[model samples]
Target: MKALTIEPLTRDAFAPFGDVIELQGARQIPINLGTTIRYHDLARIDVTDAGGRAIVNLFRGQPRVLPFEVTMLERHPLGSQAFIPLTDKPYLVVVAAAGELDPEAVRAFVTRGWQGVNYAKGVWHHPLIALDDVSDFIVVDRGGEGHNCDEQALPESLWLTSEGLRGAAG
Candidate 1:
């Protein structure tokens, strides 16, 4: 039987694919929790108020990925996206350009996020990967009327196993 080998996920190497938003050192800026913070005098406001609802899709059942097949797939065209791996060990994050999802390029990434994870806009990738375990997360995206989402399952099953990565690395 064939096997797949996993590798480490890096930021600089992944920049060409998309933004690797691994919060290495971002501390919480306390600004009085109860009061609404308004800013009209600031020179530049970096935050855009996109009034949207945060949706949390809980999966009580175990997360399973078939051999050479995708477990969870999702596409977002509007706001930026994120995939926070719930496990402490390394997981997989396969991303590609919009309308440019190649299986070869997708197979190259096997990074991990320890704290939290978030990806920038227009980055195409699988929804969430729990690596060796199942994970649950709150998906924050533009939840409005209109269809700006597309999810495609590959015709052939593609498994990311330990042997597979070692073969590719060689």
Candidate 2:
């Protein structure tokens, strides 16, 4: 199995697939009598295509351990999908380009508990890869019309391991 090295999630690195949602380097706005700081426009929510509407979902994911098999990847063709970690623990994201699933194009990223990602329309990605234990995510995506979810198998096997996490930027 080809092993994936987990890289630190950065806006520039992930721009090809989607936006990196985080508080750092975001436009801040003061609201509600200046009691709240808003991190504005962190991501573009593009769920309104083909009579679709934006929707919020709570995705509770079970944890995965190392040497994780990379068998399949999925994508949303109709709109973008965002996963914001509700649990203050690190997680993994595996993604590829927008078109066909190239096993060689697959990349892995590790979030710093506070960061999130918005997968652009049709970008191939693995489902949530929560670590250690059960985790929760606030998912924002399209809710109506057309087949948004598509899953495909990998050409070959790939594995993500603990060593990858250790190599990521802390």
Alpha-carbon RMSD to native, per candidate: 6.8, 0.9
Cα lDDT tens digits for candidate 1, 17-128: 4444454533334366846443222111111225544443343223435344553345565555544444454456656556655544444366554533344445567755
Tens-digit per-residue lDDT, 111-165, candidate 2: 8898999999999999999999899999999998788899999879889988888
- Candidate 1 is scored at a TM of 0.59
Query: Scored by CA lDDT, what does every candidate get?
Result: 0.49, 0.93
User: Which ranges of candidate 1 are over 4 A from the true structure?
Assistant: 1-7, 23-61, 65-68, 71-73, 85-87, 113-116, 165-170
TM-score of each: 0.59, 0.97
For candidate 1, what is the total of clashing residue pairs? 16
Off by over 4 Å in 2: none
